[model samples]
Target: MRRKAYDDLLAWKNGKTKQALLVTGARQIGKTYLIREFGGGEYDHVAEFNLATDDVTRESFLAARSADDLALRISIAADGPLVPGHTLVFIDEVQECPNVVTYIKTLVDRGEYDYVLSGSLLGVELENVRSYPVGYMSELMMFPMDFEEFCWATGLADQAFAMARDCFERQTPVPDFLHERLSALFHRYLLTGGMPDVVAAFVRDNAVDNVRTLQADIRRFYNRDITQYAPRDRRLVIQEIYRMIPGQLNNPTRRFKVGDIADVQRFSQVQDEFLWLSRANVALPVYNVDEPKGPLRAAEERRLLKLFYSDVGLLTGTYEKRSTLGILDGLGTQSGETSSSHDRMNFGGVYENVVAQELVAHGFAPYYFTGKKVGELDFLIEDADGRIRALEIKSGSRFRSHAALDKALVAPGYGIDEAIVFAETNVERDGKVLYLPVYMVSLLHRTRQLV
Candidate 1:
């Protein structure tokens, strides 16, 4: 329930010439709850309205003559006067009424009221919203809780979280006790996801079944949106694309190639649908990085773009029980499922994407390295000095340095400062690359200087 984004809102409230703000994120990410928590505590009076649940109120605003009249209508609906500096008005699910975006823009432009509008999906509503107060309004992006935040929330706080936060200068090695606990929780997070409701359930019941049920409910919400939000013709295509996510990410080439989708019939039909999904924040496109520099331009090959869902747990939910063999071992039983061939391929790809997702959330952009012949580096992470650090992520621990990694290091111009091979446990260096556990990837961002 504690989110750092709320702090940004407070800072915005206290700023000079503060404008109405718009908060955007995927569905059920606690957008509404965040506004209420932040606004109620910061302002003298809080008036909240949901455009999706309250249609009559929306209709009244639509019929109003001007922005001032619309604000007056909202105040009447809330059974209070909209007083500036005293009231913080919040409109949740603003995507449910596209017309309101323009109205809010006009109100902010005309200085009618201080407000915050939150939307789970704005791609559907952007069609009608015109003349956005671009310069006047601040847009805030909210993401699912990161590993550190999750630890703090679940009462698992220890040195790992502290170290990741850079509370100290030197890198603190995760002690054995902390590593084991964190490893288990990380696996659980990969299963249950950061969806607020599911996370709350896990915290409340601590039951795997409860978490799975909640995950299913979130999937159902997504499935329903395919029909509810997308056009009839685009509905099935969107559904198919959604279904292909787990398999696509699990491929030897993590990129989402058109050939991977069975019964594609046509790739063009699904392309726009995929873009819509990305706009909704349900799917994130990890572009193939040809350059490690800032603005990390996507490769000329558009087909190389990889697709990752908003949550790792949501991705796992799509696979059948049998297919998830090595991908995950489930609650507490480690059955050594990684031995199977199918499990090996699928599991490896998923874990790589997981690492990629986590690193991206931590302000690191990942790029892959491929040799002229046959080897490939899983990722090339650029540190603060603009130095490229090559990294290879494995499923568990069974990884041998590839020829591509060797070729990458010896290549002409690109000078890699350090090479890392991330596995299941910390180990010594193998030739050019240093071996580290997958859990230690967060620590890769900073250098370990001895005191």
Candidate 2:
């Protein structure tokens, strides 16, 4: 039930940043719950509004003239007094009223109360701002429960996580007992995924059927969002692309081909739909990079990319039945044996998607690299220091023979010092490449770039 984002909120309040706070994430990603928790604990009063469900407030927002007018209109709908310096004015579902972003500056200048907003589709709907609210608002992007946060929800102690972190930093292996336990939890995470309600259900009752039901409901909710929010002309296409994500990742190259979705040849044809899914916070696109270098953005081959679900577990749910057996069935087998079997079982894409989600949660913009001379590299990211690090996600024990990774390290001008391979194996090293247990990805957080 705990979230790493909770700490981010606490820091924002304690620091008195003075900017209107906006928390953006996919629906059911706990944006409202966490903000409510903060408002209750930190303020004497919470003047909260939910724009999506409150019809009167939605109409009032449209009719309001200025920050003062909007504040008064919203305050009339709030539960309690809006006291200066003692209240948190929380606005939820701002996607319904994107103008809230424009008026937030005057609201902050009023100096009446601390402002906070939560919304999905901020990426898609908050276009009136010209840019996504710079200088006037502080934005935080949230995602599903990562492995470490999942550990806390599952009641794994601080001491155990500290042990795993220490071993990872020191380049040592975890003990047999704790290693197996964490590995099992990682598989369970793959099975349950990170959606808040689904994770809560599994933790509260050890029922897999209930887990699948909640996941199904979440997917249906997203489908409804497409119907309600997506452009009228493209709703069907968006839904079709969303459904194709699981099958696309299951392909050998893991590249999402625009041509496969329709008879189209160029990415321009469906680029908006792809961007909509990403901006709506439901899907993730890891574009291909032409070179492995610093400032990975400059090298992006935007047309070529791999698409993954925002939640790995949600991706698993699309498999129709007994998705749990696919991931856990082959654990602890030799790396090579698992690799071959994973192809048949459709687990490779799931593992890759899990790594993509973890890297993103830890503040890395993931990309893949490939060429005729070099082989296929799974993920490449810039670290806190802006150095390039190559990552390979191994679904099984055959982790030793990575042709692409080996070539990338030795290539001239790459300046790559070491590589990371997150496999179902204990921590070990072969020269410059450090192999880590998949569960330790929780510790790979790049916690820098604070202003």
Candidate 3:
């Protein structure tokens, strides 16, 4: 499968001042796969070492006294020679031996072979490393396949994505046929998500049930990690927080309330657990900004926040607990199944979550605004030009603006001249607001660049 991160790896590899690269993301999001793919294709010789599974390799690193010694041992361990400029040395599961991270400084100082290190728990484990090779390491964050990458993997041509980008740049509705096709594809993406494993399975068999099963297994793996890595007493708290994500998102306020899952009256008591999930890349938290401005994070309300699962497919699998293929196929409600009012509410949350995912994938820090008298704006975004824009996400065709968005657009302090509404509607402009179909959310970052 194609990944945008691959291009980043290439840039790092070809840079003038090269540093050891550290690839970080949640487990199973393809950090390992991407590094290996880059190494196999870009290097004449690839020395791959996985510390998690290779005890001998770990022992060699521990025994080495110098970069040259470590290099020789790693070359032997990889059953290959590490040549300068032509070889790529990849260290997988570096969290298992955090000390290995510090070795990057030595390796880079020696200027022998190019190095790439990857770990699922790098953020958590880095705390214990003897020293962080601060200047010697470059980091790239990997995320689940975005919509464009998903399109590439599923046999859609690059031109298709280009066409979508062109439409977004022009602020025009896509041709009806392409819009319908993309809408159907986006629905499948909601269920299959950008998880490479789930996407590959669905593409191969065209079975939503199989994808759901894989997603469930992925969830189990994450739970197991919490149990295995979290402090013994806090494991249950972390698990409770993880399980409450779907319900929290469904709340009308769209803020994660610690009290909803636990009996805690204060967020500080469980704040570390929330941080743990975010650091682990299992949850993406959107903070509440009291004021919308250039430095949005300055006025963040830490106590009020929304947490979204890292992948929308996993969220759907956990929330729906059944195959959504029928729903995607126009069979609204399946026979013999009764969906509650809460289930109906979840549809909006799911749509919002997907928009959040797309925004995050494109390097936006998700923030939202709730006004006492004006109403709520689903998201507040700052474009490349440092302009704050209000984004409202609507799940259905009945698109209507709230006073908060209108107020933010024209308010003196807000400085937001235009607002964007993402809904099941075609692209159109209404006064200062632009109405766009939900799928176009993925094109937002690119559209900003064009503007």
Q: Which candidate gets the maximum lDDT versus the true structure? A: 2
Per residue, candidate 1 scores C-alpha lDDT tens digits across 1-451 of 8876777787777772747888887888788888999877887788888888888987876687667788678878995666776888898888776666677766776554578888877756565576666666777767677655566678875666664334223333456676567667766666666777778887888765776777778878888887788878788878877777877776676767776566665556467878878887787766555543333443323445677887777776666645554434422112122443544333665566567767765666566655455366677776666667877776654456355677767776666778777666545565676766565665455331111
Q: What's the TM-score of each model vs. the native? A: 0.85, 0.95, 0.93
Tell me how candidate 3 scores on lDDT.
0.79
Which scores greater on lDDT, model 1 or model 2? Answer: 2
Clashing pairs in 3: none
lDDT of 2 by residue, 1-451 (tens): 7898888888877775558888888999888998998888888999888898988888899787777899889788887887888999998998888778878888887778899888888887886563444676777899998988887889999899999999999989999999988988888899888988899998999767898888889989999999988999889889999999988987777899788876668899898999999999899999998888878999999899999999988988878665347566444232235333443464678888899999888888999998787788899988778888898888865777788899988888775655999888899999889999888877887873223
Per-model CA lDDT versus the true structure = 0.67, 0.84, 0.79
Which scores greater on TM-score, model 2 or model 3?
A: 2
Q: RMSD of model 3, in Å?
A: 3.7
Clashes of 3: 0
The runs of at least 3 residues in candidate 1 whose Cα sits more than 4 Å from the true structure, single-residue gaps closed, are 109-113, 158-160, 164-172, 262-269, 291-295, 298-300, 320-346, 363-374, 380-389, 400-402, 415-418, 427-435, 440-451
TM-score for candidate 3, please give it: 0.93
Q: What lDDT score is found at residue 342 in candidate 1?
A: 43
By TM-score, the best candidate is 2
| lDDT, model 1 | 0.67
By TM-score, the better pick of 1 and 2 is: 2
